[model samples]
Target: MKPSLQLKLSQHLALTPQLQQSIRLLQLSTVELEHELERYLLDNPLLERAEDYALAANAPTTGDGEIAPRSDAPAEPSESASPDEESWLGEEAAYLRQPGSFDEDDDDYHDVQAASISLREHLLSQLGLMTLSGRDQVLVGCLIDALDDDGYLTQALDELAESMPAELDIAAEELQIALIHLQHLDPTGIGARGLQECLALQLQALAPDATRNLALEIVHKHLELLGNHDFQKLKRLTGCDDEALRAAHLLICSLNPRPGAQYSTADIRYIMPDVVVRKLRGQWTVNINSDAFPRLKINSLYAQILARQRGSGLAGQLQEARWLIRNVQQRFDTILRVAQAIVDRQRQFLDHGDVAMRPLVLREIAETLGLHESTISRVTTQKYMATPRGIFELKYFFGSHVSTEAGGACSATAIRALIKQLISAEEPTKPLSDSQISEVLGQQGIVVARRTIAKYREALNIPPVNLRKSI
Candidate 1:
């Protein structure tokens, strides 16, 4: 092997900070991006979103018919068109005057609300309310650290207990006490081991009675059977007939599926849509908030700092500045392309509703739009679009396919919607089983297997035959 400077070129994926930032920005949900923007407003002095931008951009357009209203522009272009467009100057000015109005309750778009209370805040408040020994408090804090994003205690009490080495030989009873305290947090079931325990804790917090007791039993003993739609086992074990089990199931159904989700930032106020969609003149269009996506420029302060280098020849500073600008531009392009693809593929979704949505895979969109699967995934990850139906994540449009009799495939999402429709209309007493649903679908010329129907049902959070049984 020759260990000389051969100068052979090779390619490898190097995760540069700029690339990382772009990737990170691509996946951020609308709420998440707003939080990041606020962070930047505090940390970076050079970046600013003010009335002057719209004014300056508009000043040139006023001189002539250069920015005439387009005949093709949708009626609510302000909601769909990029806010960066010259026509959006008025809208941008409106956006700046009243930032607080961005609150979900407020119809105004001008306000910039403060960050909402996070999960940690909710738990910490509960921790303070409890009267535990200082050592016990420390142990509880360790347990909280072991809690998962779903707000469940993911780790075993023993494992979490071990993390509190100082509290070695901790009694299970003491851990249970702390566990009970954790469940009382703002979002119920903050420290539950699993969904069953989480639902049980939430139910216990509700008004206590025989129905509640039945709900608890269903939650603990037959929650898995409940999920599988095993109504017979539930009936056998609870000594309840199908009708009685239906009533019991209703009690459990009333419980929150994700008990810890109340503390989620999604529930905290409203998310300002970066993109808006609306119907106009029988056509659907997507509009980006070019203004909402602030024009990211290097901080003038940082530029001044670099200018004052005084022969220091700081290659690092120069490199960092260039990198930041490139990253900002690249981020915009990535988002813009993704937004376009989303509109192109999901236009039917906008025009009609969920069932009208065609089966769309990430690979199909990625290939059509000339991007990698991972790149498409990154762009769609947490981003949301505001449409007539309501706000939905970018990923919502991408689901598995089910073929029709004509060989055209329907989205798994659409299949789920259809299944939901069927079940919703089914007889309460003789509720549609997986096979029955499949037959119904087959009759409608939708080629699907019972297993496939069940799979889609499961994905849609639909219970099986027994669980769905009524009188």
Candidate 2:
């Protein structure tokens, strides 16, 4: 080994924090981008959501010349960020520029609710209205804590009692009262022990008889058998005539098994398309959503301010300004790449319909786009594809395939689609049996199992044979 030091020049790929943040923001869905921006605005007093800077997309930026707003959707201007070069935090990044705000967009927060409060919150609010002693309030508090995300109390009283603080002194009777109060809340049937109990609470006001009793037994004891379509066990256990059992089953089916579902705090975020696809002169063309990316420019106003008074940390300030420029550019570039990849693979879906969708796996797109698999996954997860077939999650295009008669690959989704059509077109007086549907698919050389057909039907949220049968 040579001891003397020699001049050497080497280059290595290093992901600086600013670059990493750009990459992360690049792939976020529109809603995710909004949430992230909101969070950053909260944390950084300097950054804002571009409320007054109406110049967002409509404003002009220096790079790539002037981008006009598309007739279909206008672009947004970049967010407000500081050009002030603090000694340490130094220069901040400018947001992506856009053509302008769309003429069609009208803020509608006045009507609909954004993701509702958790079941516990709803219950606690209702609980407060009740006149309870201090000890009773403590017990109710413990019960509220026991509720799961789905709003069921999975833990046994023993476990829950031990988990609670000693001051609560939650006994079984006290717990029962709290449970009653929870059930009585706006979204009924919450705090139930299991699916059976949940449904029972919802149906409590119903008179107990052959029909109601059958439902209780079916939901409580034979729910497993019913799921498996073990008709033999159901016939023996319920001990009702087939017609009576059928009625009972229909009644049970109408109940919401997870009552807390209506009040779920989990955000059911609406999908916003990153790209818009339309058939232009019989050919499918993709348009990247220029709306989401506002026209961002390094606030020359702030830049002029900083340029005149170059302080001691001039190098650091310049680096930040440059870094912000690169980050904004990278964000647009990454979004473009992902949008192109989606348009490339999902053309068939746009041309004909979802039934014509090609088998598009995440890895396939990731490899094609020269992006990491996880990166592609993140880009696609919670992301949507807008087409002539309407909007669908990116995940919907990728499905397991089965061989077809013409020696072509067929998608499980296509098979399910076909099954749904067949079932839907069938006479209500004569529903197609699962086995019969399986036979039909086999004759067509699709070769799906009867069990598989059942699974698919269930996945489509269709009821089984007895439920499907009608008067």
* Best-performing candidate as measured by TM-score: 2
Estimate TM-scores for all models: 0.56, 0.61
How does model 2 fare in lDDT? 0.63
The Cα RMSD in angstroms, rounded to one decimal, for candidate 1 relative to the true structure is 9.4
Superposed model 2: Cα runs more than 4 Å off: 1-153, 158-191, 201-204, 208-210, 217-224, 260-264, 305-327, 330-334, 337-345, 360-384, 388-404, 407-416, 419-471
What are the clash counts of all predictions, listed in order?
Answer: 9, 20
lDDT of all the models against the reference?
Answer: 0.66, 0.63
> Which candidate gets the maximum lDDT versus the true structure?
1
Candidate 1: tens digits of C-alpha lDDT, residues 399-445: 87877898788887777888999999988778888898899888888
